[model samples]
Target: MTAFRLEQALGHTFRDRDLLQLALTHRSFTSPHNERLEFLGDAILNAVIAHCLFERFPRLPEGDLSRLRANLVRQDSLHQLALALSLGDFLRLGEGEQKSGGQQRPSILADALEALFGALWLDAGFDVAGRVIVRVYAGVLDRLTSGQGIKDAKTRLQEYLQGARLALPQYSLAGTEGEAHAQQFRVACVIESLHLRTEGRGGSRRAAEQMAAERALESLESAHDFSRQPRS
Candidate 1:
């Protein structure tokens, strides 16, 4: 995957090829890397995403808009976009980092994707960069549900119980697995008032807790008579 291919996928041609090259160059590869561009791109990405969300959901409150923007610009979301563009194939990494599978790492891919956007902004302008970002994220934006922007799973679960004057959901580490660098965390989310528990696993404890909370919320929503029970 050359810069030309990336440009085609990104739907923007770079006036300055060096910018694109620098965007793909990881710090492990050389001194002139993508970190600075990543910084610039992070700000641009947030602004572009915020503007898009503001336009798309005119009736949404600021909190909802912020949550939606956060979800859209999260590392996982950016990594998915990077994978769709095959951005990793064009990354310039050092020999050790390349051998260690740095290309597939979500952090690296997300940062490089941001750097590419930064380069695009520099090569063209904010208008072009904004258009490209909206284009790349169109599918994601379209698939978003009305309930998505309200709150994240953990926050929603906590708020739901707190509204009823119930004890907040308790999260505990269930276990862990895999190697040091690639370990998986298992977290349990407990709702003792309802005598219900749900578990989730992810690459990080925070992620696992979020997954568990999502599952717990689903379980609560699906129960036929659970909400009718007395609050503790």
Candidate 2:
């Protein structure tokens, strides 16, 4: 995939294409890889998420804000964002890593995303980078706000399923769109026992899963037939 396409997805064209190239360069790929950029990106991501949380939840205590930030910046979260960007297609992975499917791995994608953030900061400075970050996180932040509670819909749905002695819901990345900045993530939420399937779309996979879970829960609650209790 060309950097131009990824740049379009990011909604931020790099002034120095080298920085973007370096960000996508994996350690396994070559010398002067993105590890340093990854390190810097990690800091930038944390700070950006933290600031957003602080501003969004002024009444909430520091601990709560920290937890929210942690949730938003976790490896899985970053990986979802990377998936939204189809970033793996643009990664410069070594032959071995490529053969091993490292492109789709969570750690690699997350680290690459961080490296991209670092590259953005270097290329456009923190202010511009921060704007891009916020744009990418908008759906996630909006979901968090809608819930108001720390426990998301997926958590609540899982607990409900467990309490009912039913199998856990299955979530899969169904597909994604080539949208700008915050790409659309489509996910399928399925419960085999009930023969139920729900789809959701959001800016990130996590958000999409949560939305799917919420829909599943709603469907289950509204239609009492789904409440068939499992044998003890």
Candidate 3:
């Protein structure tokens, strides 16, 4: 996707096109890249997301609100949003980076998305940028109303084990498959105290780990139910 196309999708036209171009440029591409913009964008994203969560969950505690914000602005979530916008296609990467598949890297994609927000802020103003952010995250924020977003599988599993004074769960990559851009990673989640092990596969290692943790949580929950059952 071209920059113009991305601008249309973002619903904001850049007054200064160079800012947008710079936002999409990786450090590997040129000296004047997106890092500064990314820094600014990261702050804006956090603040905007925090405000949205605050208004959405007025009754939620601070800790729960913080967790939801973290989940929403995390690298994985931003990378997913970048993919939705086809942002990688607009990135300007050096030859080496291009050959090494930097475009598909989560860190790079997330950083670029933040930089885009930063550029929008500079080109127009905070209100305009905030509007764009809200538009981009509307569906995600809407689904988070129940406070269910506070606890992901990994967080739930960790808390479950910690509450019992057991060792925290450990995750390791079991294996990987497929091409560079579309690799599937298999991850194993282990709980030494419970002698529990679960494996899951996904397009990214973090995703695979989450899936494994979810499976482990389910197994642990089932075990708890069995233990409480009357003698059989």
Off by over 4 Å in 3: 150-203, 206-232
Candidate 1 weakest ten by summed lDDT: 223-232
Global Cα lDDT for candidate 2? 0.82
Candidate numbers sorted by TM-score from highest down: 2, 3, 1
The segments of candidate 2 whose C-alpha lies over 4 angstroms from its true place after superposition are: 146-232
Which candidate number maximizes TM-score? 2
TM-scores, each model vs. reference = 0.67, 0.70, 0.68
Tens digits of lDDT, candidate 1, 1-232: 6678878888898889899999999999998999999999999999998998888888888988888888889986786678668788999999877766666566888999999889989999999999999999886676566546534568768877887788998999999876577666889999999898999765678867876887787788688333453454
lDDT tens digits, residue span 27-83, model 2: 999999999999999999899988888888778887778778888888767876787
Which 10 consecutive positions of candidate 2 have the poorest summed lDDT? Answer: 223-232
Which is the winner by TM-score between candidate 1 and candidate 2?
A: 2
- lDDT at 97 for candidate 3? 74
lDDT of each: 0.82, 0.82, 0.83
Residue 80 in candidate 2, Cα distance off native in Å? 1.1
